[model samples]
Target: MNKEALIALGLTLEQADKVIEGYGTTIPKSRFDEVNTSKKQLETDLASRDKQLEELKKVDAAGLQTKITELQQENAEAKTNYENDLKASQLSSAIKLALVGKVHDSDIATSLIDTALIELDTEGKVTKGLDEQLKTLQESKPFLFVPEKKEQKFKGWDPAGSNLDKDLPQDIGFNFAKEANSKGAPAEKALNPWGQ
Candidate 1:
C-alpha cells in the first residue's frame, strides 16, 4: 500500500513496511535426527540412479551390430538373385517370340539370350541390342529367317498396255485384276537347315 493508504488503516508507514518485509520465515524443525534421515534418503536415491545408468553403458553392442550387418548382406544377395531370375524369364520370352525354340537349337538360343545386355538403368526394359542379336542369330541359322514381303509393282494405266487409259486406286468404279504367272510360288520348307 502507498504511504497515505497505510496511514488511513491506523498504522504507521514504518510498521506496514516491517509486516510486508516479514512475508515468509525459515522452517523450525524441533528434531535434528528427522532432518538428517530425509537428507540421507535423498542422497541414496540419487546414487542408485547414477549406478543404473553406468551399468547400462557397460553392455556389449558390437555383436549386435555385426548381426545386423550380416542380415543386410543376406537381404542384398537374395534381391540380386531375384533380379537375375526375372531377367532370365524376360530373355526366354524374347527368344520364344523370335521362334528360336522352333527353328534353331535351344542351347544356342539360351546362350545368346543369357549373355544379352538388358536395360542397365531402368527396370523391366529389354536389352538394347536384343533385336540385332536375334537378327545375327537368324543369319547364322537361316532356318529362322523370315523373308520380308516384296511389294508388287502395278503397271500405270495406258491405252495400249496392261492397264486401260484411266486413273486407278482413287478412280470411282475402278476394280483391279491380278494377272496369272506374275509372281512365282513360294519354295517349300526344306527339311535340312544346312541345305537352304
Candidate 2:
C-alpha cells in the first residue's frame, strides 16, 4: 500500500501501508482558491474603470455644447458688424460721387439733400448725426458745374514682327495644313482628339 493510502486511513504512511493496500485521495485545493480571489479582484477593477469612463464622456459632451453656443453668438455679432460697416462704406462712396462738381457755398443745402438721397439709395437710411449734417451741407449747395476731364500720357506702341511675337507663337498664324495640302483642303483630320 502507498503512503497516501495509509494517511487517508488515519495512520502514518508507514503504519497505514503496513495495514492497508490502496492510495489516498489527496488533490490540492489551494490553486482553485487563488484563482477565485484573482477573478473577483479583476471584476471589481473593471467595473470601477467603466464608471469613470462614463463620467468623462458626460463632461466632454457638456463642454462641446457650450462651445457650440458661444461660437454661434460670435458668428451672429460678426455678421451684424459686417453689414453695418458695408452700409456705411457704400453711403460714403455714393455721397462722394454725387458731390463731384457742386459749388461749396452757393446751394450748400441742396447739395446736402442730394448727398442724402444718394446715401438713402445706396445704404437704405441708417444714418447718424454726422451723416445728417453732411447731407444738410450738400443740399444747401447752389451752382451745378461739370467736372474737368483728366489727361492721360501714352506709352510707346509695339512694332510689327518682334521677338516678343516669338514668345507668343500662337498669335502667329502657321497653317500647317495649307503647307501640307496646298488649296485649303478641309482641315486635315485632327492630329489628336482635342485637335492640338
Error of 2 at 172 (Å): 57
Candidate 2: stretches off by over 4 Å: 1-59, 103-119, 122-196
Q: Give the Å shift of residue 179 in candidate 2.
A: 60
Q: Give, for candidate 1, the lowest lDDT window spanning 10 residues.
A: 170-179
Candidate 2 root-mean-square deviation in Å: 17.6
- Looking at model 2, residue 173 earns an lDDT score of 29
* Residues 145-186, model 2: lDDT tens digits: 333568987667665434355564332224444245455445
lDDT of 2 at 171: 22
Top lDDT prediction, candidate number:
1
lDDT of each: 0.60, 0.57
Error of 2 at 192 (Å): 79
